[model samples]
Target: MNQKHLLACHERILPYIHRTPVLTSRWINERAGTEVFFKCENFQRGGAYKARGATNAVLQLTDTQKKNGVVTHSSGNFAQALSIAAKNVGAKAFIVMPLTAPKVKKDAVKAYGGNIIECEPTLKAREAMAEKIVREKEATFIHPSNDEQVIMGQGTACMELLEERPGLSAILIPVGGGGLAAGTSLAAYFFGTHCEVWGAEPFSVDDAYRSFKSGKIESNASTETIADGLRTQLGDRSFPIMKKYMKGIIRVEEAEIVETMRFVWERMKIIIEPSSAVALAAVFREKDKFRNKHIGVIISGGNVDLNNLPF
Candidate 1:
């Protein structure tokens, strides 16, 4: 997407999404030996930054499309986001969620007026269900992280971050489907003054890292990670943007993800999911490289299952 598209998306979704706050912690800065800013999307609508993309996608639909409604498959955050966005626009949202998704997320989707369809906990099952809904209901399918509108909408978070904290040396974001990473990298390229963008992924699901090295989109061999929101693979729309704009990808272990989550909660006094912690863990993974530099970390979401915390 171009700068104009990104700017238009930020304006289009402004009324639907929250302009989440940016936070900083002296303890975290000292530990990382850098001035780190946290773009807290955890406090956003639906408790995630996905609201930005979902809202943008829904608002752009034609009248006929809105009447037919929208369909998507997501494990959690995007499901809640699309539900809330659709409800705000008086459109129906059919969400195909895996049976293994967190109950809290499922409840949030229902509360937001989405029709939930549970399926086997597999990508194939989720996509098949979504496709079936599209055929039966004549609904428009919005891929959670693959659509052009969604990617532009996701970039607005980084755009806001740069507006608040200019001159940042780099930005670190968690990579799951690569939408947010691609968007963040584009925002850094267009808005920041020479700011580099990096991605963080769990070693258990390090497809983004492998893909970066191989110069092609790659799939994860294992989905065994505490960062449940990050278990998906990258898409065609997002991969090319990431390949061109992202500086690198850092892979952190499961233990590192858990420790970073707890550290943020204990020190920053904010609830961040494991997916969000992946970014901070990357900074810690190579402190020497980022020493004394101004860095921005996008806190992707805070939809944690209190009963099943990794800590």
Candidate 2:
């Protein structure tokens, strides 16, 4: 997408979403040897930056489409985001969640007025259920991170971040389906004076990392990471943009992810989920490369289950 498209989306969704805070920690900076700015999207509506995309996607629909409603599959943040966005736009939302999804996320989705449909915990199962809802109820399907509108919407977060910190040398965003990463790259290209976009992924679910190296989409054989929000593979729509604009992907160990998660909660005094912390973990993994630079870390979400924290 172009800057004009992103600007239009920013304007359209401004009244609906939050301009989440840009935060920093002296301790973190000292440790990482860089001026790290955390885009605290955890404070965003529906408690994640996914709200930005979800709202934008729903708001971009036609009246007839809105009347028909929307459908999507997400185990956590996106489910709540779509539900809330649909509610704001006076449309119905059909959420297909894997049965293995955390109870806290499932409850949040229901609380946000999403019509929950539980299915087997597989990508195929989730997509099939969403399609079934679309066929039976005539709801429009909104892929969490693959739609063009959704990518433009997701880019708004990076746009805001760059607007607030134009001199940033680089940006680190957690990669799952590559929507946020691809969107951030567009924002950096259009808005930043001299900024690069990078993605942070769990080593256990390093499909994006593998994809970047292999020059094609890649899949993880197993989802065995604590960064549950990042288990999904990159999408074809976002993959091309990512390959073109993203500098690289940094893969961090599971221990590093958990440690960074705890560090943010304790030091920053914010409850960042494992997915968000993955960016910080990745940053710390290559401190020498980032030394003295201004880095923006997009804290993607804070939708963790307190009852089962990895720390």
Candidate 3:
């Protein structure tokens, strides 16, 4: 995707989405051994960075396309985002979610007026179901990742971070499908911000990390992390962008992820879900490396199920 295209999308989306805050914690800074600035995407519309991309994709659609409605397959947050975006654009949203996705996400999609379709938690299965729905209902498909407009929209989070902290040393984002990582990294690269962007992933499902290391695509065993949003295999389109612009991909253990979640909850008094905590875990797991740097980390989402504790 062109940087100009994404830059324009940011301008179009600013009036629609929240300019979520960058919260700094003195204690987190001490623990990470860095000046830690947290871009709390947990505070975003639909409770994630997904909103920016989803809104942009919907906004790009014409009135004729809006009348046809929109369809997408997501683990959770993306569905809620597309549903809310679709609602804003006066279009119907048909969202296909895995049976294993969290209830909080499913409920949020419904609240935003999306029609939910249940599917197995595999991307192949989700795509199949989404296509079937699209064919039957004559709805326009809005991919959760891999679409240029969507990726540009996802880049807005990075734009916001750079705009807020122009001198950031690096940015750490939780990687799932790679849209956020790829898009955000490009934004940093284009702005000449001298910021190294990194992707954080759960070791349990680290296809993106393996892809980065092997210089090719790699799919791990079936989904295994409590962070449902990080299940996807990185896109062919996204892999090149990530490899070119992202500094690196880091994988953290499931235990580390849970520990980070607990720490953020207890200290930040913020309800960040497991996926958002991965970036924080990345820094804590490698405290020696971040000794005196200024790091920006995006907490990708906060729609957690209070009843389910991964620890």
Q: For candidate 3, what is the TM-score?
A: 0.97
> What lDDT does candidate 1 reach at residue 227?
94
Model 1 has an lDDT value of: 0.94
Alpha-carbon lDDT, every model:
0.94, 0.93, 0.88
TM-score of 2: 0.99
Candidate 2 lDDT by residue in tens digits, 1-311: 79899999999999999999999999999999999999999999988999988998999889999999999999889999999999998999999999999999999999999999999989999999999999999999999999898888899999999888889999999999988988899989999977889899988999999999999999999999888999999999999999999899999999999999999988999999999999999899999879999999999999889999897
Please, what is the TM-score per model?
A: 0.99, 0.99, 0.97
Q: Which lDDT value does model 3 have at 305?
A: 85
Consecutive 10-residue window with the lowest summed lDDT within model 2: 189-198
RMSD to the hidden true structure, all candidates = 0.6, 0.7, 1.2
lDDT of 3 by residue, 1-311 (tens): 67678778999998889999999988899889899888888999999999998999999898988999999999889999999999998899999998988887888899999999999877789999999988998999988877778888888888888888899888899999888988888888876468899889998998998898899988978787888888888887777889999989788999889999999998999989999889889999888766799989988999998888776
Stretches off by above 4 angstroms in model 1 are none
Q: Which model, 1 or 3, shows the larger TM-score?
A: 1
lDDT string for model 1 (1-311, tens) is 78888999998899888899999999999999999999999999999999998999999899999999999999999999999999998999999999999999999999999999999999999999999999999999999999888998999999999999999999999999988988898999999999999999999999998998899989987799999989999999999999999899999999999999999999999999999999999999989989999999999999999999888
Which candidate leads in lDDT? 1
* C-alpha positional error of residue 116 in candidate 1 after TM-score superposition, expressed in Å: 0.5
